[model samples]
Target: MKVTAWNDGKKTYGIRVGIRNRDRFFNKSWRNIEVDIEGSIYQFKLTPGFWKHCPEFRDSVKPTIREWLEKYNLVGWPKRKPPRFELVQIDNNKFRLEKYKISL
Candidate 1:
């Protein structure tokens, strides 16, 4: 997933789940999820709707993005250039996100 900043520059942000992985949660219903960013736990409710083809963690998910950026030291990077994190599914409701830095 990628980090998103609001178009109006209102300091709003969200984590947009990729379409390829959205199908992992096939229930198509609102479900509670606990995401582990580093060691912090962020809680979010998976939105339920047929129109929402791509699952997004908005509103209450701002902290997740902030913590992720801070944890990964990507705070001052250019716009739309943050690396995508790997979201690992631990179970039906638990997930872990991590960004691996490549060393050349």
Candidate 2:
């Protein structure tokens, strides 16, 4: 598993997670999970079709996602609501969700 921070211009923006090695459940290509962070909260969107392929998506990935968020100092920001997430999957035993706009 690999975690990468993405930036636009001078500010750190979001993260992309990539995983190699196909698990027993999924095979074909690598997998990626994306997270968009705004202030101290993050969000991931999931669709029904993705759930069909991997029912354990949230169970398998949420902890790692939290770890990555903390590692980047992107968690626990003062916000009106807590962070939100959705379940999704990719080819690798890994998964990635995507896209967010950040304020400087």
Candidate 3:
């Protein structure tokens, strides 16, 4: 699975995941996965299908997305105020959380 991210110019960004078979002919279309980055926090919503395609990312997706945002300077760091981190579960399997620290 290959993950790619892009901004939508509406204070929101999108992540696309692509998978290809070894034969190089069986390629699945990109899957639009919901993701957002605020300061040092990265939030991602992974569905059961998404997890099935890229389960390896389950534990490292947050940091990986954060790194991508930071590499492109997409996230901002505020020195005067720090944002609070919270984890809210949308359901039994869906939730959002904030992680990582943004440097000043």
Candidate 4:
């Protein structure tokens, strides 16, 4: 699945969830999600309302994810088109978030 970066016009930054896929990775009740990036596991939440389908990284773990993205130059600024990445479900309630690179 493709994940995009987003900012709330403030210090906060997160992944944006677009149309929901037919193959569901998350449950309908919308519980907290855990994603493993590289080796660290970050906690994310399903924001209320229309965004409930996408999981937003919680503040407690926001800086870490942001730093990792920045370190690899994989992030896009708020005004420009946000960077996109690949999200893979490795197991139940478990997923791996990865940066995608295209080859010529």
User: Which structure among the candidates has the greatest TM-score?
Assistant: 4
In model 3, the clashing pairs are: none
Candidates arranged by TM-score, highest first: 4, 1, 2, 3
What lDDT tens digits, residue by residue, belong to model 4 across residues 1-99? 776766666566766555563135666565567789898888776556334453444344447666766787755564667777788888776778888
Q: Please say which candidate is ahead in lDDT: 1 or 3.
A: 1
Please tell me which model should have the higher TM-score, number 2 or number 3. 2
- The clash number for model 3 is 0
Off by over 4 Å in 2: 1-62, 81-95, 102-104
Model 3 regions more than 4 Å off: 19-43, 47-68, 71-104
Q: What's the lDDT for all of these models?
A: 0.56, 0.37, 0.37, 0.63
Task: Give the higher-TM-score candidate: 1 or 2.
Answer: 1
- Candidate 2 residue 20 Cα shift, in angstroms, is 30
* Cα lDDT for residue 39, candidate 3: 35
* Model 3 Cα shift for residue 47 (angstroms): 6.7
Model 2 lDDT per residue over 1-104, tens place: 33333332232233322233213334444243333333333333332433344222231334545565456565654443223332234433334443223221
Global Cα lDDT for candidate 1: 0.56
Cα deviation in Å at residue 78, candidate 2?
A: 1.8
Candidate 4: lDDT of 6? 61
